[model samples]
Target: MVDWIIFLPACFALNMACGPSNLLAMTHGAKCGVPFAQKAAIARLIVFVPMIAASALGLGLLLTASPFVFGIAKAIGAAYLIWLGIALWRSAKTLKSEEFLDKSVSMKIAFRTEALLAISNPKAILTFAAFFPQFVILDAYWQSYAMLGAAFLIMEAIAIFAYALGGSVASTFAADKIPVFQRISGAMMCVFGTLLLMAS
Candidate 1:
């Protein structure tokens, strides 16, 4: 049996972490709107489900054992994040001249960005592999893991909503200063990329 008391809080904490993906959610929410961001954020869960399944099936451990593979994954992720940061920074200039956000941001673009960001982050898989096992029961391994995965997805959805709401609220207040918000988000993304690169 899974320990709901402990696992719920811990899992929620992990979901609520101010990670790249969550930051991206906030950025999207500010740029587009909460409803648009929430819809796009579903792509994260789509990617995570297979990742969690893979972790449960033990491929996460195999990948972890291979430093070469892990390094490649981390490098790709860091590079993508840095590139995204730079792109956003450059785009901030264009946003400043306009009173409204570029409504040109389509659902497809947002969906793809969310999906790629989630997929590129190797830590997502590692998180599932490392964190889920602690709460899983050996005797009912599959059942317990399934339950944990469901719980994680639920908590993740809530976290996504919370972050999106926060961004939405901020954007509402800073309606006249959207460009400044974009610049800050862009800088944070760059910092996150650099930190990910430096991580052991």
Candidate 2:
């Protein structure tokens, strides 16, 4: 059986790879004077949990059917990351006041965006497939799988919360210099994307 302890670090790494957008989103909400903690918590519970569950199950089945499919998915994900990285990096150059507008974004929109982002990430899907079954004993499907999935979800929630809190703290420092900070954060996101693509 796979050691449960190892899954925590794996989940953390996966979150670190895909967490920039979530951090940025929460920071944007915070800038608009929205309560980021509550919104972030809600986003995880209402959106991330279900998405992770469905994606895990679906990807698990897909990998069982054809392992090669994951390679293609990883390539696609890498390409998408590169594209996103470039866009974020470019936005860093053209920082504008309107970009940080306090416009109200609905919970539904936040939930949907997060869900789509998490689902489309090949790293996330691959992680679920590769790591989840490690804990599952040959015949003890229910116990092991449930524990693994639950551990992933809990780790994800904690990591997201940490990211949001970090964003909030960063925002406080950049309150008066929003544009500059946006550019810096955007550049950081680009770096993250580049790393993800290279790793893939």
Candidate 3:
């Protein structure tokens, strides 16, 4: 269990840290609410943990062995992120700027959007590929990493929930409430996409 003690904090801190994922959650929660954030959180976790586990189990090795495949994935992910950014920016333009959030985004769209946000993040792939191995018990196979993965996901959900709650509170006092969330989300996606392209 020492691995759990050592790794869980690192995982929590890593997840809670400033990143595009948290940025999206905070900004989005501010615009929507707790339910929106929760949906996004759960959807993101469903996609996020599996991908990390895949990498931890064997996909990371595959990527290492096949640079060409990784390159292709990197390119596709980068492009998708930018595409989402453009879509978000366009949506922002469609909606009227209002001080109060008069519009409600459905859970399905929110879930899908958040899932895409989590999946498109190449940094998560790279992070797990690098960090997850450090704590693995060689003989334990999947069990060690599985424990870590569960802890990471739980911590991640809590961190996002906290961020969302804080963001919602901050939103009320925001001077430029209108367009704040959309603009931030759109901008972050574009920035993340560019970063991913650069890293690729």
Per-model CA lDDT versus the true structure: 0.87, 0.58, 0.75
Off by over 4 Å in 2: 1-6, 9-22, 25-58, 61-68, 82-109, 195-200
| Model 1: ten consecutive residues of lowest lDDT | 95-104
TM-score of each: 0.96, 0.68, 0.86
> By lDDT, who's the top model here?
1
lDDT of 3 by residue, 12-72 (tens): 8898886767776776677787667877778889997788778876886687568787777
lDDT of 2 by residue, 52-153 (tens): 465445655575367477566555655655565566557647655455544454556556545545555565555666666666665776566666777766
What is the Cα-based lDDT of residue 34 in candidate 2? 38
For model 2, give the RMSD to the true fold.
4.1
Q: Which is the winner by TM-score between candidate 2 and candidate 3?
A: 3
User: What's model 2's TM-score?
Assistant: 0.68
Ranking of all predicted structures according to lDDT, beginning with the best and ending with the worst: 1, 3, 2
RMSD of each: 1.3, 4.1, 2.3
Q: Can you write out model 1's per-residue Cα lDDT over 90-180, one digit (the tens) per residue?
A: 8888765244455568899889999999999887978898899999999999999999999999999999998988888887888778777
